[model samples]
Target: MNLDDDPPPTDAAAALRLIEDQQSATARRLNPDARLLYWPWGVAWLVGFGLFFLRFTPGERALVDLPNWLPLTVLFVLLAVAGAIQAVASKRAYGQVSGDSARRGRWYGYAWALGSVGVYAGLGRISEHLPHDLAALLWSATAVGFTGALEMAGGAIWLDRDLFRLGVWISVINLIGAIAGPGWHALVVAVAGGGGILVVGALARRRQRQRQQP
Candidate 1:
């Protein structure tokens, strides 16, 4: 009896059961819990932009009296943490999988990278010439707008209505925030944009649980 040799074939029914079991296991591993996917960004946006609001209020004096650079630095740090979490989660969900879905995910990731470069690079020169408040508004608005648009794109690719609606909501609020100007923009995004993402994450968790139930 050579251990390396193929085992005897199972009947069709047994083979089917085996396939089903494998699929179930794969699904269990690959389930993209939206909470995990969304919560970190929610927290990042909430805290980061909240800080921004405090440090850069429209009045002559800043509410928190923070150094000019602190809020932006903190925001960037939190965003980096959130991005890392999302990357890890995505890898766990899709690393072993391959096909059209995987290909789409890869392309989408590239889009994020490339789009971010384009936005920042396009703004870099102009930002240096703008006034402080205007620069803040410009940077925040463009970043938020790009993010919302990408979210909509992701929703379309995945055919998820909830995600699509969330993207629309984000874009709308981002526009309102920009219209409101610098300090107010941060406040709106901190409350509405971050808050909305958190709410959607909760709802997605609920839906995922319902689908997993017996």
Candidate 2:
């Protein structure tokens, strides 16, 4: 009955507990209900892009009576605010999964998404003060930068690389097109740059769903 001679049994028990914890974590990852929550947002993007893109003109400035860029700026700031809220809520919801180490901090994208909102908001203000085209150029850069950060986690999960690369490309093209200002070049940017992000976003979303499947 000497406990000092029972080291092997103690080690085996500890190993069993570790295995159980891993299994529990894996089960949570594959939850189907969580996967289902991702689809409606994708659908909304498809609709928004399809309706507005073909006819979108720069400086349309969706905000009502807030000056040209003011409206757009407001929209972005609101988005940033919304993102900040979501980021906080998600930490409460998903707990540690909201941090990195889980698919490179996919939840952190929520924060980055909000950050894009700020960039556009700044651009909106600048556009109001400066020459129309210059304001647009700045806005475009801000928009792309925010978009890239949001996509970083998404790309890691979906593309297996940094999503920021796509962001850089998008920001660069948007910057050029903003400077180019109007006509076919702008059209090309709208269709290509925006569309590319939408497409890749859709695919990344899909990968997220599949990962959660049973």
Candidate 3:
């Protein structure tokens, strides 16, 4: 229980191992699991937008008989849940780590908050002027586009290839869906955008496990 009572590392190898152990602990504390960062959004997109596709298929008649407000409600609820999860994960990972990285993270978080407000403000005004289907497409495209842009920015900040690639993929699908129009957009994003993120999250977790192994 006394600091002076314990023996130190007996050899160079022991000392190196001690250092490695400390570095690993610090890394873990500094980097939250990628699954936590990604999977929540993946599920949100997958289920939320999947429902959107069913409910708002391009034709006036919906493929599935869902309440008019159900898809939007579910999507917003899931997005809020994802945001909460990411916020908690970020706080736990970076709460103690200070420096430029912490500053950048805080700024990035601010960007997300402010960018969302701006997007909603602009969309709210313009969406009212558009037809229902076009309005829906505009909302989905812009939301996805905003997310992809932020993902790319985060990747650039962290120098994370996986994150950047995921962002690129999201952005591409968003564009394609926008071009394709409403029903198809939701289907594409729900399948490709959401599914791709899930795959990336799984791969990231696998890499983390491999790195942690002896």
Candidate 4:
């Protein structure tokens, strides 16, 4: 019989092997190292925003009197550094992999970028009519919500439970902050947004190290 006309394999041994192969492939595609690549980015965000909030605290007056542009500049610099770290880490982790998982990761980055623009623009427009403190609080809360949504979407797309849990934590924290009102806005962002990112980053690093152990 011609090779093209051969029947599908029906042997029990062959079926078992096929199943094992599929499972192996799936495991490889969801490489755990890929998740670890976000650790640095998370840490950077935590540190950057944590410092930003310190200025507002009574005892921490270092950045309080600095030109507003200085904080913005520092934030941009930190973001650039974090982006570089992520790029390098991702290349090391997923450079050899090609297929749906890789494609999804690339698209997820795009989604986050687009979502950030939308959040900034929307918040800016809405802040116009609100009082200064209220506007600031709303902006912070909405930004947190946007970040949570991105993390949740990314986790679902990549099949990462850790990221999904982090997303939920962020959303819940933001909601609580919102309910507490503008008075505690800065504290909420510092504790919830910065602290949450730090915790997640540390957890990711720990998991990565554990997986690498012999």
Q: How many Å off is the CA of 171 in candidate 1?
A: 0.4
Question: Any residue pairs clashing in model 3, and if so which?
Answer: none
- Please list the residue runs of candidate 3 whose C-alpha ends up more than 4 Å from where it truly belongs after superposition: 1-6
**After superposition, candidate 1 runs with Cα above 4 Å error:** 1-25
Model 1 Cα lDDT, one tens digit per residue, 78-132: 8999888888888988888899999998899999999999999999989999998
Residues 72-173, model 3: lDDT tens digits? 899889989998998899898888779999899889889989999999999999999999888988898999999899989988998988889899999999
Indicate the worst ten consecutive residues by lDDT in candidate 3: 205-214
TM-score of each: 0.88, 0.46, 0.92, 0.69
Please give, for residues 134-185, the per-residue lDDT of candidate 2 as tens digits: 5544554455445655555455564644255555556666667556664333
For lDDT, the strongest prediction is 3
Listed per candidate, the RMSD to the true structure in angstroms reads 3.9, 7.9, 2.6, 6.3
Task: Work out how many backbone clashes candidate 4 has.
Answer: 0
lDDT preference between candidates 1 and 2, better one: 1
Better of 3 and 4 by lDDT: 3
Each model's lDDT comes to 0.88, 0.50, 0.90, 0.69
In candidate 2 the C-alpha lDDT for residue 164 amounts to 53
On TM-score, the leading prediction is: 3
- Checking candidate 4 for backbone clashes, the offending pairs are none
Query: Please, what are the lDDT tens digits per residue for candidate 4 over residues 7-49?
Result: 7668988978877777766555445454445555555556555
**Model 4 RMSD, rounded to 1 decimal:** 6.3
